[model samples]
Target: MENKNRLLLYVHFNRNNQLSEHVLYQLQQLRHNFEEIYLISNSKLTDGDFVRLTDSKLADGFLQRENVGYDFAAWAEAMKHYGFDKLANYDSVTIMNDTCFGPVYDFSKTIEQMESDNQIDFWGITNNRSHKVKPWEDKEAIVLTDHIQSYFVSYKQKVVQSTTFQKFWSGIEILDDVVAVIIKYETAMTKYFEDAGFKSAVLFDTRKEDWTGMVVHDFSVFNLPELLRRKIPLLKIKAFSYGAEYLTTPLVVEQLKASTLYPIRLLIDHMTDVDYPDRAYMLGEKTLTFNHENTSNNLLKIAIHLHANHLEPIPEYFEYFNKYVQDYELYITTDSQEKKAAIEQTYPVSQLKSVILTESDEILSWWDVATKMEQYDLVGHFCTQRNEDKNWLFEEVQQREIKQVLLKPAQEIFQTFKEDSKLGLLVTDVPTFYQQFKTENLTADEIWGNMAQIWQKIEFRKDRDLKRLSNKSLKYATMVWYRPQALYNLLKIDIKKLAIDSGVLIDEFFPAFERLLIYVSWTSGYDFRVSPSLPKERLVLEQSDNQVPQVLGVDFEQIRLRKLLKELLRKVKKIITYRFKLKK
Candidate 1:
């Protein structure tokens, strides 16, 4: 059999305008089947990335254009650049995009299988069935037609040579709306070619399969595990981000690791560009103990910043640190000379770097010391003020939470950072005190309150999705173990000036700033993990009803019944009012 001359046009886009390792890996895998590969990037490449892409020699041709009209526009631009006559010379041309992760298995096998079929004019890795209403359409009454998913579609020589294909490419308008582009191109392209007498086939015929009760109509993302099991070449990138609600991304990640020789780091690097809520779940490693027997050899340049506003907890704090931490440069920030003297007395002045007196609150003090922190590789921040308002049990939980990161698992935490360069922040999991009142959405007002104006001062990454910031599992008391690089954006801000401009109280500023730290770390291209204070079973035991105390002369059981009766009466009143309004 004569080998066909295959060409691949791969569309690439990155918010940072840099080529990712995953794309390069995909191109490397695709080289087996395609004689020539062209990379079309919508995002203008950075000089470094441009050099990297060109130096790799993965693509025969490269096109960088204005990022408009999404992937379809990029494909159209590539087709126009090549000209129809030149494109027709190839036996087959495959148009694919960087929206997917793989070519997990060998691409040549899939290409061979598709090429063997003589009847099909064009083919795609997967296809969608005609549905009542399009996923994005609610009021438009649009019925999505059965079509080959545009992410990965290959056209035979006959289709490429045909006027219909040429006309379709020429007629594409650069639309601003994503849905408009999808309706005009992606969902319509297959039907347009078919109507012009091009017979289309798909590797996975989703029309015959039952997708009943599925979260989405796009099977590429929702049914990725099954597709991988059946030897599908690509995995949609959305599976890790928005698609997580419908499917378990960690399971799919594990499957890829076990089944294929694909580099998992490529996936992790790519995830930094998107809003992945499961960063902790996916990248976080629980540190039980330092793997090394001699932990002294691997000791990092550690800085422990203790905001000792209250002098009483100074002894307890130092005692905890003395017990677990082997070595660290201690920097204490105290408000009053009296408190500084007390802290100095509690911990030896020889061991301490300095006891700086600052009028600014905890967050401001941390920011003031940000310059000093940059010198250290790992920085741990804690405040004695966190224990002030809490009751005995709550205080104990808070202390344990802080100890989890800085004391009990201190060595393992250090080891985890040393081993994983990408691991930025290790925060204590939602403290038991806050767990009882956990809400999925913590409003900006609720979190920042009067200090909300501080957001304007902080320079956040433009590429980051600000919406995801609101939904993050926040570190309430802002106790954290982090790499200095993780808080680069936050640390760069002139926080003193910000406090002056915003007129937010120094005491209230820290809590508000704490809310934004997780987001800042994420935008800085770092991953964070939640370190649980205690084991799950132990936490359950601590949170049990037996731990609660009954107030003297107060009948809690009677009060509970009264609350239930009030709720029932309110519901009955609402029902009566609703029925009366309906009758009226």
Candidate 2:
């Protein structure tokens, strides 16, 4: 038997143009399998990243190209640079991408097994069966043929030296559309080589149906545990990043942690960098409860800032805090001296640290208290407002916000904060009404635009993903328990100037600020979790129900009347448009 020499070309991409730990870990594991390894990146590497790549010494060579064409383009560019004549010196060549989080087990065993089977000219880790209809194409029902998945594919010298392979690499063009690239390169490559009289095989074939009777062709996405059980080396990163319908990411994460020596933090870092919005929801501790007994105080400094515009809720709010919070300093702001006096008369004045009279709205009051935030480790903001509208939905949401934030025992919440150093903001879940109407009412372009304007004012951390920040779930009512340091950048901003010059509506500013709070915390290297009155699971189920909650006490007649008015307005607009057209 001849001594076999193998070459590996690893394709990588990072939006920040920095090399990630996972990619490095992958190369470190695979370095031994190949005689020489080359790293081909779509992103132009930063100076620091280039230095680190050179220092690692895992790759024999490196190539950086424009990020126009996905993994296939990177591979093609590598081939073009190396040339077919030079590549023919190796017995086998493996082309892999950074789209997965493995070799969960050892890479050597899988490589040995594949190398022993010399019958196949080329091979891949997985293969897809022919589809009745193409997945990406909706307008036309086109059939998709069976092909080897392009993520981790190896070619024997015969396939590599063949004119067909050389021609395929030569014909590679810059494709802007990802779907087109997938169709032309990834899906077509296997068939193209097969038509040239080359045999192909997959380590874990998806062409045959299994006992699970799972229809999903991508075993990497759905049958990950089974794949791992069968000692399939790689785990697809998309299983956790994009998420599968029936999959629970946390379970998979736990399995990976318990079973494999693979560094889990690498996966976390990659997900965070990509700005996957559900990263926290799927990976971090799900819900922090307020019902648990406080075991230790740890003496964390706490401050509560109350904007008591209306004095009606002052006494009740104080009672809730007194019962729940172990200790805290209080700051009160009122719109008038008369209202301040009334609050002082009704509530215990001795407990109040300071009572300031402010002529401006709550936004200005928030700005005035910003300087005092540094003194406290944990700070909470609450505002008292009397709803002028007799709208039941608005009242219901307001009550829910108050209950979730204030009614929960503060000692337990503080203890939770102490336990998780990274826990930045403890907020109530999105109101059921808002969640139901999120697409229609809550996620307006105006809201996102307002958030963007506010975000521009702050000196946010550079590494934070702006796209993820835009899609963050917010505490709409602006009631939250948060670490003061997490909100430092936001609190430093002069709210009065923002209110006047930003051209954002006073109402809009509050909601936008609330949304940006989560992002600010994230940028400050912190994570947030929901502390709902109900268990998060139960809350989700309740929210999913189509029936309106009885607690909302909504009047069906009012809804019907509103619907009628909308319909009437539409008819009037149509009539006006017809008359205006005739006049024109």
Candidate 3:
């Protein structure tokens, strides 16, 4: 089935902990099954002692991360080196972790089955079942959705050689740009395969396992390891050895063995999400969805936008949108009035409510709206996530840690400001990131979206008996700046004038930067991290337990980046005044 016999069994073994020993036993036992076992290690793969590891009857060569550390994540930098290790010589690349395994039988047969099916994107496995299946729960098995952290994966040589790989977790700088980068590349790859009319997730693997995961949570009748032991005796039954054998009692084993392809069927099910999905769906691109699920959950529906065209794309896109959304109540919190009004006119606004001030609210945050708003869901423009190597922001500011550092101040500033302060407006020297949230419109059930999901459940739980979402971690971000540079220094930097300036344009970079984080719109309080759309009045109210105006914070680092951004407004003023005076 595969064009080549050299199956590159890729695993990045870290001598770091419990996982390493398990991986070693796995490699030593399975190396004979593969032609030449190759490994990429975070450990010292080349050290003389480690070199001895290569002498093993199983491992032929070893690749190490440190050899290729190009100042990015250990993973991203390692790819180029490992590409040298075996990917070049190999045509069919099967990528999987030790945790990700299937039938022990001929790996060649498995490749044959995959290719005979004509799925070059057959990156994951699926369970072939005889019984009826649950439709919605597919992703619980194996999701290729939000982000693919390597657990188990397989790819063709083309996927590995052709695409530029990136990896990132939930946080990174300039997320939109990072996300745009990831989407742009992945979409391109997926489209290339797609235009040929084969389904692929760009560089992402769209193939789903039958049950999505091997460890099915009682919900899926996905039988246990006991059921598997007979079918796959070399099964190294992890579930049972770890005291989980009860999941596969005799009856389930009998049912599983009944299949013609005993071990393979089970493995396939474990890889694909043939069932259990929509666990938390990605937001759709469709701007408006007519709600079929209805309650008097009225507040405002904000358009959590991910992009801005320097030139207007729609003269009156909203006019078309307003006609559909007007019946249900909602508030609009975007940056453009022409856009907002055109949208408002499109939908019936008799029930529509307030619009957030385009000036004060920079359009760079979904965290704010989810925290501030009373109710919301990302209806469209759903995104896909892969590991950090494919993530975009890693392309620019390029450090994973720097993206993490920015949030500390954001959380602090939010905690300090209370809505009652009525501080008509609080200013931060930090240009784009404001820690304050205006709380005038919060409802009785609204709680800070910044709190953990458990807290949101406890705080907002209608059931008085269980204080679930409320008791979770609720932190207040306070104004940590002003003291360092003082508020006056901020005005002198010209932020106050910028805020006052009627035609002040929202910067274009905010949305472009957030995609590096696995960003989705805020629904549960626990979901707040790097925000996609800035805190719009409605989304904040939806996220808030009580609506109030509060401080927006950013590390003075942003202020520093801004000083380098452009000439100071005051400096520009002086330059213009001098030029005019000289002209006289």
TM-scores for every predicted model: 0.75, 0.62, 0.29
Clashes of 1: 0
Output the better candidate (2/3) by TM-score. 2
Model 2 C-alpha lDDT versus the unseen true structure: 0.73
What local distance difference test score does each model get? 0.73, 0.73, 0.32
Off by over 4 Å in 2: 1-5, 16-18, 132-143, 210-216, 222-231, 241-247, 272-275, 279-355, 358-584
Instruction: Supply the TM-score for candidate 3.
Output: 0.29
lDDT tens string, model 1, 1-584?
Answer: 24579989999988777778898888877776788899898988777776776787787888988889888888989999999999999999999999888888877767787788899889998888887664464555688799999999999999999999899999988999888888879999999999999899987888878777667767887777678878888888886676553325555776788899888778866775565533532433232323323245446898899887777677777776776666788999988888778777767755589888985467767876778889999998988764445365676666766675456667777887898887788777556665554423434455555334555655665645555324334455377889998897777877667667667545555655766676677777777766664452222111111122222234558877997999999999999999999999
Compare the candidates by TM-score and give the number of the best one: 1
Tell me the alpha-carbon RMSD of every candidate: 8.1, 10.0, 26.5
Q: How close is candidate 1 to the true structure, as a TM-score?
A: 0.75
In angstroms, the error of model 2 at 224 is: 4.1
Looking at model 3, report the run of 10 residues with the lowest lDDT sum: 278-287
Per-residue lDDT tens digits of candidate 3, residues 1-584?
32445454455533322233334555664554456665656555435435456655556665555423211233333344554445645555544445433344344454455544545552433222222223345423222222222333345555544433222211212223433433333223333334544433212222243444455422112334422433331232233223222323323333444643444333322221211111011111100112223222323232322221211323232332243322233344455656555555654546444544343233332322333332432111111111245544432221222222222232222222222121111111211222243323423332221122222222221122212222211112111111111111111223233324424333322221121111111111112221212222211111123332222232345666686566577688899999999999
Candidate 2 total steric clashes: 0
